[model samples]
Target: MNLAVFPRRGYVKDPTPIESCPAFSKALGGKVNIFIKRDDLLPGCAGGNKTRKLDFCMADALAKGADTIITCGAVQSNHCRLTLSWAVKEGLDCHLVLEERVKGSYKPEASGNNFLFKLMGVKSITVVPGGSNMMGEMEALAARLKEAGRTPYIIPGGASNPIGATGYVSCAQETLQQLFDMGLKVDHMVVPSGSAGTHAGIVVGMVGNNANIPVSGINVSRTKADQEALVRKLARETAQRVGMSGEFPDEAVTCFDGYVGPGYSLPTESMVEAVRLLAQTEGILLDPVYSGKAMAGLVDLVRSGYFAEGSNVLFLHTGGSPALYAYLDTFK
Candidate 1:
């Protein structure tokens, strides 16, 4: 996937590290070699997978003459934080529509990304219930902003659209290049599958490049069937958007939804355990939501003999660790 052909804004200055995690692997009983692609270390207010996606999304916004940016996400959404962070740097006003996924979850005084949203000086924020029509809301906001004599661009939740996913396609290329330079070939790679852009991007990129690496996703908020379908559709669309020619296998878009405890944004035992294990062993932190659930899924798969013995697995650590401060009771 040659992302250079696409319009992009600078976000990631260099390739984030693909570091070996011998201690983490040993702690998991050494059934397989483990590594982490530290997308969490990406350059931004705080590093995250969204930084890559925004590189392309903001570029499109700029090309469209956007003066203000509008987007939607959960109250503590890392995407919202990063989007606002970049918008401030880009000199564009940002407006956020936060979904209170859990009823009564959107407290004005809540910490975590919520506080950052205020500190970042977002133009405005409208809190809505979970499952709201995010696109419709963003469109309405755009209309109002237009009436006020401002141009607005809307980035869908998670920035998971075909355009934003280009960042992940670029990442797929980067990952393969790093592996080649190190003389390593990984068997499987896992990432948190939320809005499906990251998962779809990697799937399309790997298939297009014939890297032969399977990219899997762990669902943070949806069922397996739903998440897989979304990822599959977006992967096909992304392949078309990038002008890649190939028949992507239907089985390539895999997702696991077992780790999403009671509901979205709620704490779970597996997540708590996984967060502590990784932090204690490898000195890496995962947020209470996405990456924690993803690590839990990866850990369970490893313990259940899901991977071939001695096979190598890579975890895409899509950073959101700062949200841990908002979920202090989970750790306590």
Candidate 2:
């Protein structure tokens, strides 16, 4: 695939790595060898998976000669945090539309990404009710910017569009190369499925490369049925963008929604334990919302013998550790 034909500004040439997690592997009782692709270490301000998407999204914005960026996400969103980070790097103004997916979570003085947003010098913020039309809200922001004489670009939430997802397609290719070098064959890969870009892109990359390894998504929000449909749709779109042939079969999009307790970003007992386990045993930190719940699901599945003995399970560590600081009270 001619992935280089796609625009990629403000992007690092290489992905992070698929490294051995001795701490986590030991914690799982050696039933399944656990490895992590440290996407959290991707070079960016505070770093996270969103950096990959923004590499493509921001590239397109720059190509279009935009001076300002507008995007939407839940309050304390890692995607928003990374978006503002990239905006600062590219010297573009950023405006955010915060969705209160959980009511009363949008405190202006809140810590974590909220504090970072201000520190990064975001131009403006619009707080929207949960489930509002995000596209409309972002367009309104762009119109307001234009009225003020700023050329604005709208990047969709999570940057889950096909172009943005190309980042992960590249990631999939990188992972396959890493596996070959390390002599590690991944039986199953697990990742947190929130906005679907990472999940979708990985699916396309794996399918296109004929890797044949299944990628399972642990949904942080939405039901299994709802999340799978979204993932499959995005995967197909992403595959088409990269000029990959064939449809991603519906059966390939697997998700377990059992870990999303209460609602999005609301912590669950399993999530809490998962975070603690990673911290204490693996010395790795997982955020409250996405990776923590996904790890919980991964742990349960491993214990349930979902994979045969000696199977190597790969976990895509799409980072959000900064969000952990905001939930100090929950952790305490």
Candidate 3:
């Protein structure tokens, strides 16, 4: 498929890299080689995976002559931080609807992304109770902007739509090139599955590029069946956007929900261990909610002999390390 036909919106650079995670490897007893695709290092606002989606989403916004950007996410959303970052960079106003998916988690005095949101110059923020209709909230925000005579563009959470997912498809292509250059072969790749864009886009990109490596999602929320369905739906839509033919096999989109403990953003014992291990071993910080849980799953899967001994596994470090601060007590 010719993805070039889609507007890149000024993010036309090659992807970061698939680098060896020596620290994380040693923590796992070196049972399997661990490498990371550092999407977390992608440029923008202390960096995170959402930058990839914003590359395309911002392009669409600019194309539509939007002067303001509106989006929604959980209170400590990395996506929200990055959205505001990009909006600042593009000279557009940014507004956010903070969802308290976990009741009482939305404190006006909270740290982490909330602090960053203010520092990043978000024009406004509206806090909604958990389970509020996000689309309705966004529409309301847009309507308010219209009343003020501003041209506003709405980007869905995590930019999970096809346009946002193209970031991951592009990321997959970049990963393949990096692997080739490094003379490495990745047998499997694991990533956090939340909004589903990263998982879906990577699936589409790998399939389009004929890279047969399986992409496994460690669910940060939702179940295996539900997450898989959401990912497949997004992947197919992304594939169609890029003009790729054929369907993504149902079995290809896989997720493991065994790791989501208690609920989203709630710390688990495994999550704490995973976070500390990565930080101490590799000096790489992972947020408690997403990447920490994902690493926990990856470690367990490796220990269970899911991958052959010495198999090279790539983990996409989607980045939310800042949120770690909010959960300081958990680790302490």
Candidate 4:
């Protein structure tokens, strides 16, 4: 709530749209109403949830006089793509450590964000196994850059730290304002949870604003328990960053892991159907890895009557549609 105390580079000058999804809602065949927060349209090379976090993270990098930015993520990481994209905009060299989350998942000639990594002028991209020590690797990269007389900043995967999470805190403010203006009350908010920043930031934001709306995360990587713990920790840290009580209020966070399907970035039957349904019904596309699966979960929940009758549910469309190029075979 006290955003004035912190510094921001200002990536979001305009609030992303909150639109009704009548076709998708009717597809559910329930009394429930559905809406979407189109964060996928946020500014960046391909636009995504990471754009919000970068507003703060990039500002910190600039204040530190960082000449190069180093960060890590999975092979097709939307966060990595957006980070490099913003780095280029700020005239900073960007380097990446891409984790092959699934062994042999890293293909130098791969499309999607991997292609963007090269196109965006990334100074370097190091591929490591899923279990590689990310912070240590980034530190070693920083040391090497220092020896070369370049100042470097290390951004954690997904910018999950307290500072980066503030972007979603601001997002919460924006969403609530929009809902009030539109005379709508959202009973539940759904998001794709991976690396925790977006989910945690929304939880922290909701608590800080006393929005009284529950934030549900469809876990894209970790299990429900693991993801919940991670999100709670980040939410608390984000709250502390803004001079809040730094404690996640009771029932502030919830996550569902059933939609992960085979594994990280692996496609599932449900995800494919959800993607197709949304594309056909709303002319909207959701990336395979994150939002697609989250949509699948939302779809399943609606069909299963998870929400009370006549409830209003909002899905946060954290974008990664550009990566759809890499998974061309999945759709066909």
Whose lDDT is greatest here?
1
* N/CA/C clash count, model 1: 0
Window of ten residues with lowest summed lDDT in model 4: 242-251
lDDT of 3 by residue, 190-279 (tens): 989999999999988898888999889999989888899899899888888887778766678889999999988889999899888888
Runs of candidate 4 with Cα error greater than 4 angstroms are: none
Off by over 4 Å in 3: none
- For model 2, the stretches where C-alpha displacement exceeds 4 angstroms are none
lDDT of 4 by residue, 214-255 (tens): 888999988988999999888877888877764667467899
Report the Cα lDDT for candidate 1: 0.92
Quote the RMSD, in angstroms, for model 3: 1.1
Better of 2 and 4 by lDDT: 4
RMSD of each: 0.9, 1.1, 1.1, 1.0
Candidate 4 total steric clashes: 0
Each model's C-alpha lDDT?
A: 0.92, 0.89, 0.90, 0.92
How does residue 305 of candidate 2 score in lDDT? 88
lDDT for 214 (candidate 3): 89
**Candidate 2 Cα deviation (angstroms), residue 281:** 1.9
Q: How close to the true structure is residue 155 of candidate 1, measured as C-alpha lDDT?
A: 96
Return whichever of 1 and 3 wins on TM-score: 1
